[model samples]
Target: MIDIDPNGTGLPGIDQLRVIVGAVMTVGLILAVLALIIAAIVWGFGANSSNPHLASRGKSGVLIACGAAIICGAAVTLTNFFWNVGQAI
Candidate 1:
């Protein structure tokens, strides 16, 4: 019988990949926050202008921005969760 190491994939640069992914996620989180702020400003303007169409679009933008933020914020957690799941397989 051969012994297998679960933690040994013999793959190189995994740490570097993790670092790159982390940096990308950080940038994405920053962009999502910016988008959320812009959406809020647009919502305020639409509300003040009393434009239903603009207001509706702004509302949708806010939802999307929030979703983006959530995804970006949870990226590391999600990645680790999936990684653990994979390892368990």
Candidate 2:
């Protein structure tokens, strides 16, 4: 019989890697928030100016920012989910 252990501490610098990844995710989320804010401002300005093209661009930007935030927040969960699915195969 063989056994496998998947403890995350098996390698050196893993803790550092975790720290870096955490920092990156934090930065990503912050950027997403900033983007959302900027996009909303653009949208409001465009609406006030009666510019359909600008408003459309701002709306797209808002959607993209929201999507980015969602992906950033779910990165770890998504990775784990895929990992488990792959393991089941």
Candidate 3:
């Protein structure tokens, strides 16, 4: 075990790790936003059209976005859970 100060005065590796996680999460969030925007646009434009295929495609896009969001949420939730368990160790 290593001593990690609450302030930035200890644990160099831990600090680097936190930076890496932040960058990864930021990119994930950007992707999530893009997915959601695409889903919304598809749905909105599809609603105004009479083509069933377009509507189906819109629904598919929405489903894909929902899936992406769920995966992201699950990953974060599981990570937090394991992190907390680790802290108890």
Candidate 4:
């Protein structure tokens, strides 16, 4: 049997790494939110102006923003899940 723990590593600044990652994720989520809002506005304007191409682009932006948010929010959980899966293999 083998066990691995991140904290077991006597490396300096490991705790700072966690804080940095958290801050990065927070920034990502904030950016995603801003993107979503801007995309929604673009979508509305396109629809109102009857510009199909613009509308399609706006729709894509909104979807991409949502995907970013999902990924950013679940980043830690997703990493842990994959790590466990890798360990089982």
Candidate 5:
């Protein structure tokens, strides 16, 4: 048989989990933005400027650009997700 708490005392448990989940999402978005900035810097160093050794870094930058794009997408998604969750309350 399924069990249910007679007095609905489970709120604290549920509330704590939501708080933690929200904190995790906030951290994730922050890290994702930082990674995007780092990737942009790498891509910029690779694609722009006139130095020869810096030229070799272009490929790495292009890869970094791709990574930044992906992280940006993830950040957008996470922001929307958290926004929606917040609105639901």
Candidate 6:
């Protein structure tokens, strides 16, 4: 039987890497939410101005922001899943 440490896999700097990844994820999520908000505002303005091209751009921006949010939200789950896979190997 093999034992794995939840904190690390007996590798140096793994903990620091984890911390850096977590910080990046947090910042990414914050930026994604801000982008979503800005997209919504732009969409509103475009709609009010009757600019289809601007509205479409805003819509695409909103979609991209939502996608970023989804990825960021799933970061922990994805990390855990990969961590477990590594442990099994």
Q: TM-score for every candidate vs. truth?
A: 0.76, 0.92, 0.60, 0.92, 0.46, 0.76
Could you give me the TM-score of model 1 versus the true structure?
0.76
Q: Model 6, 50-79: lDDT tens per residue?
A: 999889889999999999999999978998
Report the candidate with higher TM-score, 2 versus 5: 2
lDDT of 2 by residue, 1-89 (tens): 55565789889999999999999999999999999999999998999999998998899999999999999999999999998897776
Question: Where in model 1 is the C-alpha error above 4 Å?
Answer: 1-9, 82-89
Query: What is the model-wide C-alpha lDDT for candidate 5?
Result: 0.63
Residue 58 alpha-carbon offset, candidate 4, angstroms: 0.7
Candidate 2 vs candidate 6, lDDT winner: 2
Q: Give me candidate 2's TM-score against the actual structure.
A: 0.92
Enumerate residue pairs that collide in model 4. Answer: none
For model 3, the run of ten residues with the poorest summed lDDT: 3-12
Which residue pairs clash within candidate 1? none
Comparing candidate 3 with candidate 6, which one achieves the higher TM-score?
A: 6
TM-score of 6: 0.76
Count of backbone clashes for each model? 0, 0, 0, 0, 0, 0
Identify the superior model by TM-score, candidate 2 or candidate 3.
Answer: 2
- Please rank every candidate by lDDT, starting with the best: 2, 4, 6, 1, 3, 5
lDDT of each: 0.84, 0.94, 0.76, 0.92, 0.63, 0.91
Candidate 5 lDDT over residue span 1-89, tens digit each: 55443344555687677678778767765675666567566656755776556655655655665565566557658877887797666
Superposition TM-score, candidate 4 onto the true structure: 0.92
* Steric clash pairs (candidate 3): none
lDDT: which is higher, 3 or 6? 6
